[model samples]
Target: MKPRISMITLGVANMAKAIDFYQNGLGFPRHGEGEQVAFFNLNGSWLGLYPKDALAEDAMVDSNASGFNAFSLAHNVGSEAEVEQVIQQAINAGATVTKTPRPTDWGGYSGYFKDPDGHLWEVAHNPHFWIGPEDTPK
Candidate 1:
């Protein structure tokens, strides 16, 4: 199998609210026009938002679950300052800061935020890792 993630789909409780949060608030580019579902083009992948119950139905699972899902989405940046900037951006977009930006044990910097749907996102800057195309150091 190819080692690539083409997209990450988030099951949101409110489709329209989610769309507004991602598209308008967070400035994610909307792929198409609709309130039923939303898709945003990322640097190397895509982010999708769909109704929670509908997504669960498509996956043939119960949608009555809540709380942490033991998973999180990450956005890696080019610099430590960018991490803080992104965190603030998420906050201005109505996300709650779960962790303030700080130095990490791995010698990097990172922080966390929870979107309106309560999905966790980690914004980080890894000095040892190249974040852009062609593996070029940022």
Candidate 2:
């Protein structure tokens, strides 16, 4: 199997709301105009949004799950300042700020936010690591 993630599909409670949050609020460039689902082109992968119930049905799981899903999606940036900026952007885009950006015990800076559907996202900056070329400051 390839050691790369091609896409991350999020089951959103509201398609339109999720689309606006990612496309307009977080500035993810949307890829297509499909109403049933929305796709965004990321730096190296893709982010997909589909209705929660439909996604659960497709996966043959119950859709009534709530609370933490026990995982988080991370966005690594080039600097501590960038981490804060991204977190604030998410907040302004209607996300709930779960943790304000701060220096971490692991020697990095990071923060957390939850999207409209309660999907947790971490915006972070690690001095020792860089995830991708897009994380480089221009």
Candidate 3:
């Protein structure tokens, strides 16, 4: 099997709210959208949001439980502009701005935010990595 992720889908509480958070708040490009799901064009991957209960049902699990899932989705960009733009776009899209963009100790610029469903996302610029046409993750 190929070890590659073409998309990462997050189960959200409200589809419209999640859409506002990711699309209007943070400014992720909405490549495709529907009543139940929305898609964003990431640098090398795709990010998707869907109804939480539907996701749980599809996974054949109970839909009533929720707590820390222990993970966050992150985005690595090529420049400060990309990072800032994404962060601000997320904010405008209705994401609950968790942290404003700032300089990092690792010599990079980054920030964090949560979607309407409390899913965390990070936007950062790392000089050490590169995003190629093939879209492989390091």
Candidate 4:
């Protein structure tokens, strides 16, 4: 089994609003025109949005689950300033700021925000590690 995540799908209660927030708000390049689902090209991976109820039904799980899911999606950037920039972008896009960008104990800077559906996301800058191409240095 290859160790790679090809996509991350978010089960959204409002598909149109979700699409707008991701596409128009965050400036994610969208792919396809399917009415039931929205897909965004994330450079190497993909971000998908699907109806919450349908997603739960497809997984054969109860859709009544609420509150924190105990997980967060992170976007790593190249610098501390970029961390704040990305967080601000999320804010302008209707995300609720959960944590303002600040220096971390791990010798980095990070922040958190919740999307319209309450999906937690972290924007971080790690000086010790870079997740992009090997030729690119942080």
Each model's RMSD to truth, in Å?
2.0, 2.7, 3.1, 2.0
* Per-residue error (Å), model 4, residue 65: 0.2
Mind giving the per-residue lDDT tens digits that candidate 4 earns over 25-116? Answer: 88999999865999999978999999999999999999999999999999989999889888888889999999999999999999999999
Encode model 2's per-residue lDDT on 17-132: one tens digit a residue. 99999999999999989669999998889999999999999999999998779999999998998998999899999999999999999999999999999999999999988888
- Collision count for each candidate, in order: 0, 0, 13, 0
Where in model 2 is the C-alpha error above 4 Å?
134-138
Per-residue lDDT of candidate 3, residues 42-108 (tens digit) = 7768988878888888899888877877888888788889888887777667677778888899888
The residue-by-residue lDDT of candidate 1 on 30-118, one tens digit each, is 89898888899997899999899999999999999987999999888899999989999898889999999999999999999999999
lDDT of 1 at 21: 85
> Over 4 Å off in model 1, which ranges?
134-138
Highest lDDT: which candidate?
2
Give all candidates' CA lDDT scores.
0.91, 0.93, 0.80, 0.92
Candidate 1 residue 73 Cα shift, in angstroms, is: 0.3
TM-score of 3: 0.78
Worst 10-residue lDDT window for candidate 3 reads 129-138
Instruction: Report RMSD for candidate 2.
Output: 2.7
Instruction: Give the Å error, residue 109, model 3.
Output: 2.0
